[model samples]
Target: MTNTTPQAASAAESATAKPALIERNGIEIIAEAERTAKPRDLFWPWFAANVSVFGMSYGTWIFGFGVSFWQATLVALIGIPVSFALCGLIAIAGKRGSAPTMVLSRAAFGVHGQKVPGIVSWLTSIGWETFLAIMATLATATVFAKLGLPSGTGVLIAAAIAVAALIVVASVLGYHTIMKLQGVLTWITGAVTILYIILTIPHINMDAVMAIPAGSPQAVIGALVMVMTGFGLGWINIAADWSRYQKRSASDASIVAWNTFGGAVAPVLLVVFGLLLAGSDPALMDQISYDPIGALASILPIWVLIPFWLTAVLALVSGAVLGIYSSGLTLLSLGIKIPRPAAAAIDGVILTIGTIYVVFFAQSFIDPFQSFLITLGVPLASWAGVLIADVLTRRVDYDENALFDANGRYGAFDWISLGTLVVASVIGWGLVINQFADAASWNNWQGYLLEPLGLGGVDGPWAYSNIGVLVSLVFSFVVTLLLRRGKIRRQEAAPATDGDN
Candidate 1:
């Protein structure tokens, strides 16, 4: 040891050091795999999880509302292809880059602009997670009350315990674990729901369903659109959260197709079941509105009802878990230095707070909670639109090194992306805000402008708010094209320099 030279000693130390498997910026990526190892994801499990998450888009409420089930079915069937294409285009960008949605947003927004969307996603998810927790509690209580525990305080307590457990379980695992759980939950929940639909079908009043009139001709169109647009807007904004775990080699288009298809179509059966029950027994519908549990219990056998209730509760937990995990990823992508577990903890806490709000004081907070999500659609759509433009312009390729290089191609303020996002969001949001301002607001406006629509006058923005989602997408793409033209012109205008320089 005394005779060893400094060079030899240094070499020995180097030889003993463990090689780092992955690096990002200055961060080590050791949780899952080595840098060279392609992402290992539970493909089918993840796929089923996504489908389940998407199914919640049209779960219970649409059925409970007692609208035309066919309208919802049509909306889901048609909207799936369109929404899937948009989600697929954005997802492909994330897939090719091996980046999450927020990380990819950095290419379009400056690192500064990146945070706006990140916070938006984070805050929105917190509210949603809370809503899910509350809904789960409500659903659990409803199920128990139906089972003869009319007071349901015990049911509520049990539901709270269950929700806490789900958080703990979801917290301990990583993406692989979550995906597997979600897959099993989806099948169980989906099967139970489908069975409920089959059983409930015989109870529907076909004559009343036919005579329902959709609440005037115009209202019918509006309700129909609402059903379609509602397909997955609530949580679909975070599709990338789960999809990011998907192996890059998987055909993303297929995932999007299935995701959109499952999300859009599966709930229609549930709605049909609900509608049949509502149509056949209007008195039962009215009674259960105040006591939803009692209403459902009467329709379902004790065995059928218990599993159905459990399925709904599990589904709620599933949505909350996905939201929390995705929010954590978005935080990480934005350069938060916390450990993944710590990040997830922050989400759980936020969700817990939201759950409290829902469980103890739901009626007051619930309306605004839903409105907030409706408002979020514009911005989420805008970001999604920019993502599509960025991908299409680059011909579906991004240099991996550029993501780390400060002065690299992906760096910089993409004015086109930013500007397009802002403008589109404003225009789309205007559609929502104007609908409420005044009837005079619409009367004096340009005749050519489309009026905001809603569901049978039950909700505002009677038509599909998804129009905002669609418009934001189209406008962002068009603006990106305009900016691209300007970029090309400016590049040609400048004098040439040496390639190395």
Candidate 2:
């Protein structure tokens, strides 16, 4: 006879219970039973998302700042890993709170005040996902053209629709599904990427690369800022989303280490390789500025083009999937009354629309978009600085109940944090200049204080030196550390329900 005892029946039920294919959790604290992820699992998503050949395009961007091969190499080495380490620091908040990053900011900014940065985070996520989708679609069209297939307007539209659909489907399936997908993609994409590097090695001219002259100090700093903003700071807003599932018992150091390792390893190598390729051929560098992934495929052997295109597109989609997933949670944290799947679907639709516009309608979008991102980076750096300070100052776990309760220990608004964010952003903007000639008029508002500070006007020697981004980060971090410590300590010490898993 079958086992009928209570223990045997429970065992049978447990063995048969499978996790839902679509995750339903939103911004709420994750249930203890579901917090089963390990710190090492973080490596898969970070590595997969970052392993895209597009990173090679950053070499072109760095070179545009007038830096030489060795100078750019130094910038890439320092910028990539150091920037990602910040993401690792932010991930600590996830393990402590078991909530989304924006939601956890409530302890520092209060429930209502957190919305300001939350909106910025959401917009950044949507912009990045749409950008990736557009890249994938373009990659597909380029590869099809190289194969002698008809690559017309219709083909572009079709590719966009297809890429958008893949990204949407993966994102709507949510966290657990993404984790498994990312892990598998990491290996598939990593191996193909290696093969691509081997085939392209012959194209690299070390003699020409070494012959290029070094740029000015201002240009070197600009290159460093671009590298950081492009790689790590670009994704910091969503860093914690991947870690919310980590077991509370996971070591903090291990969490940071894995997060840093997964994110930094791929880009550091790719960018250095890119430096070699771009340095050898100025024409290739120019092409990369306009079409990163597609231009990358231009140099490949026709036989490898097919696999290169496939891996390239998949890598872009993998990164977009992570963005959309976190964007969905961010939407929820904004007080949207919808299920997680629906939020992801909503962001996916927006992404599709944005991709269509960028791919089909927008004129001279690339340079302007690059300038826009750099401009936005200042405020984002300010936000990161404040949040990092809050994360480091707290001694106790985030109070789960208080995170949602404005009337509780957190209150309705923390004016000090709000003021710091605003002041830092304003000053940071003044210190920066938009070097892109094609940038929109509004972007011209920057560099107002550049003349006053004797850095020369927007067209001066320091024109492209975007030291403002660094200033914003340091200014906000120090201010918060000095002024907000007591408030953060009080919040930590206040009475609340136990949030420990």
Candidate 3:
């Protein structure tokens, strides 16, 4: 009805063609007003994104490790919120700098110092992508076997590759698409989980749940630490990766609240579910040690189980996509010259092979998954401390262009951040390894450190509730503050921010 000029028509077409969020390629500074999202718009996407089997496996650890129901619940209560608290804070950090989370760390660590966190972030992303991909693939292969399809190593690897392909597609599409799918998945996963809860309810045993038989303090504490490690420290690294797209006007408190609630809800509920099922049948519980999927699958009917199976497949994609997407952004943080989609594709290929190897070739898949959690807890925890402290102290004022330019103000490296990581990592690892040696099984993952150091003993005070990570966090925080405060004073004394400053 109305005539439009050619210039106006072209502009309209360009606007329509653009993605709701995530610019072309993967990691670049997001310009303001580009795909701005609100706080509530932020919540469900994150919440549903986490409604996967990974949380189930993590929660299963609480019961598998012999923690009582109430004890497991307490740890879940404390640990999930604690981890998400860091996540929420970091999510707010997402707003301050329009770059990915790791990129923002450059401000605190300096240009050169940024590489340390970048490398760690990339490795974690790739590791998780491979791990979840393998787990989800194997779960799907099991379903394949049930459908009269021949199942074996070959079939398993094939299924894994299929899932890997999906991850690549989603990650290549980038942030907004992933979040949109997550919104749909929230309903899908919730429906399946609700059905699971219904069947599981009749079997709930009050005696088992309330039953607190004889247990030593050492074992109890160890269980709590492991539980916290499972749900909390494990996820703190990537919290801000999702929240960086929020509208600049989004309130920090609102972001923190929604992020915390969204992140905490599913894991806590699922862990309690695992605790209940532990009471119903102890034998099925043992299967968790070997096959977490099969063990849980054994609980539901074959018909109702389809939805659950689909959840695993979708969950794997959701989880892996998170890693792949972040890995792309992380590559950019490395100052790599590659485009975002290419970076993500490269990550996807490596993970595809890794997933196949871990599924078919590795002696076992679960141990590595378990070991990485505690092993990573130390360094990531330390980084979290330094990162959050820097953010709060500086009030999230960042100079973006300088972050990429080595010669720019942030400097090639900050000796303080690097030095803090080294010292904190050593201390934190020692505390964690000592705990491992204390609880050393036949194939102790930490045995390499314990035997050489001769630190063998029973559980120590630091072993309880991931105090090792806590110690690393507190130590890093204090050291960063003291170091940064002096640097600020020196900067005031001199106009230029020299290496000393």
**What TM-score goes with each of the models?**
0.75, 0.95, 0.87
- How far residue 357's Cα lies from its native spot in candidate 3, in Å, is 0.3
- True-structure lDDT of candidate 2: 0.88
Candidate closest to the true structure, highest TM-score: 2
Candidate 3 C-alpha lDDT tens digits along 283-384 = 766776666765676666677667778886786677678778888888777877777778888898999999888877777767656566667777777888
lDDT of 1 by residue, 407-460 (tens): 545445666667777778777665543222232233222111244332322234
- Worst 10-residue lDDT window for candidate 1 reads 23-32
Error of 3 at 332 (Å): 2.4
Estimate the TM-score for candidate 1: 0.75
Best by lDDT: 2
lDDT of 2 by residue, 171-286 (tens): 89888899999999999999999998999999999999999899999999999998999888999998889888898899989988999999999999999999999999999998
lDDT assessment of candidate 3 = 0.69
How many residue pairs clash (N, CA or C atoms closer than 3 angstroms) in each of the candidate models, in the order given? 7, 0, 2
lDDT of each: 0.55, 0.88, 0.69
